[model samples]
Target chain A: MALQPFTVHRGVAAPLLRINVDTDAIIPSREMKRVSKQGLAAGLFAIWRYTEPGGREPDLNFVLNKPQYRNASILLSGANFGCGSSREHAVWALNEFGIRAIIAPSFGRIFYHNCTRNGILPIELEAAVVHYLAEAIQAAPQQNKLLVDLPNQQVSVAELKFSFTIEATPKRMLVEGLDPIAMTLEMTEQINAFELQHRQRMPWL
Target chain B: MAKTLFEKLWQSHLVEQLDGDAALIYIDRILLHERTGSIALKSLAAADRQVRNPDEVFCVIDHIVDTLPGRGDETMMPSGKEFIQTTRSAAQSAGIHLFDIDHPKQGIVHVVSPEQGIVQPGSTLVCPDSHTCSQGALAALAWGIGSSEAEHALATKTLRINKPQSMRINFEGQLGTGVTAKDMILYLIAQYSAAGSAGTVIEFAGEAVRNLSIEGRLTLCNMAVEFSAFTGLIAADKKTIDYLGGRPYAPSGENWKQAVRYWQSLHSDAGAVFDREITIDCAAIEPMITWGNSPEHSCPITGTVPKIDSANKKSASMQRAQDYMGVKPGQKLAGLPIDGAFIGSCTNSRISDLRTAAEILRGRTVAANVRAICVPGSTPVKHQAEAEGLDKIFIQAGFEWRESGCSMCFYAGGESFGFQQRVATTTNRNFESRQGPQTRSHLASPATVAASALAGQLTDPRTTQKS
Candidate 1:
């Protein structure tokens, strides 16, 4: 699939539940070697599987196994959403698992960049708002929905409203499928003109 | 306006200004590792362009190869095999020096470069790996680049870069006993949070930095990426010259005298200015650990999990950290049960790191439930450790003695941790799922890792003694 210009997905908000839920927890390490994203959706949370090689372990405690959250798309997480190494694969894995946006108190700097580069909307909300989302998601499990308005840069779920800030350059790039290198290349006409002029003056080209 | 160290270096390297903040900077050296080099080489091949300066580019195979059980063998995995083959071929075809698997010099790119003296003062270096800043301990300006950028650098020997503002971090007072440079950097990260040094080159100065050995300086610069800095550098000094004196690539005889004079002139002017300045009291630092998933979510080992209430006035990031780490407000950090321990990586895998771990584990055995492994940074480091009987001590203490390479750091190739395994490691980051899926890693110094491994819990090194 060709990369699409990122569009804000607006819908009823999904309630948040966990803190510090990492990319690895979203998709385990053993399942990361598929060479591509296909077939990875099934292994989203392989550590939660109840069946084992020997027999059923019956006591597996997987977040995805909970009755209410079989297909939650919006993840409400604690501070530093992506906190480990700078693996863009983590964002790819999360995006493949159907997480369209992540509302966190804060995010790892590199992970945040990776998310933006891959079109995963990471929203930074206040602590109270994150707690409220978690509580709302857990309490009413059935009717919880969050609204993410990208143009307006606001997140509204239940009675809470949160605002986020993204700088203009990265924001435009994420929404328009532009990277720094690509933007640099786009100015090649001017660069070439300057180079030609310089070579004429210095005879170095 | 006074110039910062970055400004001094950037101006000195400027071939010409390209427009606005961008410049066509002269590059002194470019380094490549397995993970990113293959794609870079393929791109160059696709472009039908040859490397502009082969003598300035160095390639090392470190990321994907397994380093357990002494040496790694060629495997069936396409990525691993391709990484090895592509790096070897690219080096051979380009006439670049190649460090292949099990070569006595084979190790983490950052570690090996400095130890072999390929990285020198007053030079600008780039690598495909983020921790390349580890080489900045030699007073070189080293930074990481993506594959595409690497390809461009390989072909042109120049990088179109936007000059970054500079930050000066001064460390005064003596570091407390058992508190390594790793602790000082971790403490800074926690205080500044992750984005504190974004878009800036950081220079380490003051008495504490002057007192650090080359290996310790490497540890300090190695974690600059954790703060999102462009790079971290120290001024070239006697310690740096001493470390490089006998290495393979150092200049000999009169050439050495000229080189030393040039290096001495690389320091910032006394009145040089910086965009930002932060001073840290080294005496105030303690052995640190990351209780939460991020490197910035660290605290002194004796500290408690930060309470949500305390973070009430802070960024939403604090609350998120509280939630993600699953710690209730005011929870103590010591004595947390650990499932694994790792004491190796480019950050803390020098001979000093191994010796520190050996000192801690000299007479004590690892706890029955702890799965611990100690990987040296390079083959020479391993050989040196064996010569000093450090490997026997590590093995006798029940820690797995592994070969050199970036084992358990990148989670590359086939090595990884079990789900939900809590690991005390000497690597730089402890982000969520960093070691493996659902595996939680806590960043610490090598001594702290050894102490934790012996106790099978998050115990302070100060409390654990061989006696």
Candidate 2:
């Protein structure tokens, strides 16, 4: 399925400074009541977002629940964000909750790939840079807006501008909303040829 | 040219080299569980795509399936029935192999794949579950993926992957008594941070790895995800060939001979160099246990938690974990009272793991105050254990001998320990609320969990073994 294209996004950047922010924390398994990816925004950060498991009452202490950051479209976090679990629901929930981009020092490999597939830009920056951005965003939660330019591979907030690195395919997928399956299916001839030889070489497989 | 085992596997599976560092890799097998399988299948159909090679795809009713006796579609997790039913119907419609709830072959995706010989050396397997890396024990290039990636693989039988750098971890010397593959992996994660092996695939090698059983190798590779590595694998040896000898899906007769010949060559050349290398002295490893949320926050079972240095950047998270776990900075993990003990999951639910735990549980009873549960990894493993009277030993020890599946390895809104309960468990991952609401899970070997349960406290398995 093709995802929504992301060209440039400028919005509120919520700083969740904890390291190793895993997918389970983003959307706990209990919150995944249904198989479908829809209706997960309520469960985004369910454990920390709510007063109790499955409760609607918000925990005012969480960064996302703060009135100033309630509409956060970008998440700024420490290293290894989206670590643990290959559950795509975490990315789906974040996307549903208006999270278009996540800036972190590093990410769980599987989670990083999931981000581009869902049109969520995962920006990897140096730890110091991510800390700087978080401190700057926290300074003026409401007024300070972060800008993410996908085409140019850059992220900026006020005078702070940093260029990030992204692979070509994922970069194109996020920018053009390309359906990866469709593109791969286009190479049917190559896949068939490879499989034919592979089968002959190892018929047991 | 001397090539690493990983490089050989990568080159053999490479369908095409795309722009950048990515390549189109052919997938030999795809494994799935009900947790995310239904979504992948449903989305594939919704997108008007068909499974390119249905026969190559296999689905099992593992995650979220009840481990209680005579369990059906109904589950403790609300609406879990829909997931099971949907996956069953979708898998059937797609013409893929389905291990339904009643299927004797049903088990955790990682456990079932290897047991059935569906995973083989030099093949590339992809699954939607993170623990899929466990199959790397068979020397297969396998890793976890998301549901969307699952759909893509089902539709194209290929994945656009950026090849990760390769690393080799050599575990030299012999392991101490009661020290196990689980301890080796835990010690590695604790020594290096959780993100230590990020952006790399590690080949666990050396004499210690060679001496471990296939199940032990699986346990060692299972938590490679915990270390944040792309995956971990070991070179195929005679032991691996012997393990796959008569597996249901493995080739037989003439094809088997050909397969063995190929698998024998699945090893890194002597002169092959890795992007990075680390050597751990197996003798130095102790029965390791996690004290905080992340698997990295671990120590020797007999050691005390280190006092947090407030000046450290990650001290805040450490403090949070300490508070959540209700443990003092310098509290000793050994003899720490636990509310529960569990031995299951892809990590330690196999027959060999059960035998080791049962050895500790023989003629011993669980503490009256602790709740202990043991779920075998698969029906075959469970049946084998039963034939060996391991179930009776576990039941006699006061541990609930339940059905096979990924039961309480994770909370998942179904089964969970009580609020703020402490547990010594064999499953991987000790993240906060992983086993229950604010539940504190200390990961260790099955022997450790069994010994700890028998003592009603975190007792070292080595101590109990000595007795």
Best by TM-score: 2
Model 1, runs deviating above 4 Å:
A1-205, B73-79, B310-328
Each model's Cα RMSD: 6.0, 0.9
Angstrom error of the Cα, residue B386, model 2: value is: 0.3
Per-residue alpha-carbon lDDT of candidate 1 for residues B318-384, written as tens digits (9 for 90 to 100): 6755565566667777788888999999999999999999999997899999999998999899999
Q: Please list the C-alpha lDDT of all candidates, in the order they appear.
A: 0.74, 0.92
lDDT of 1: 0.74
TM per candidate comes to: 0.77, 0.99
Model 2 over residues B1-467: C-alpha lDDT tens digits? 99999999999999999977789999999998999888999999988899999999999999888999989999998889999999999999999999988898988888899999999999999999888889899999999999999998999999999989999999999999889999999999999899999869999999999999999999999999999999998999999999999999999999999999999999999999999999999989999999999999999998998799989888998999999888998899999999999999999999999999999999889999999999999988999999999999999999999889998888788889978999999999898888887888999999999999999999998889632
Pick by DockQ: which candidate is best? Answer: 2
Reference-based lDDT, residue A92, model 1: 68
lDDT string for model 1 (A160-184, tens) is 7777876554456557765444444
Off by over 4 Å in 2: none
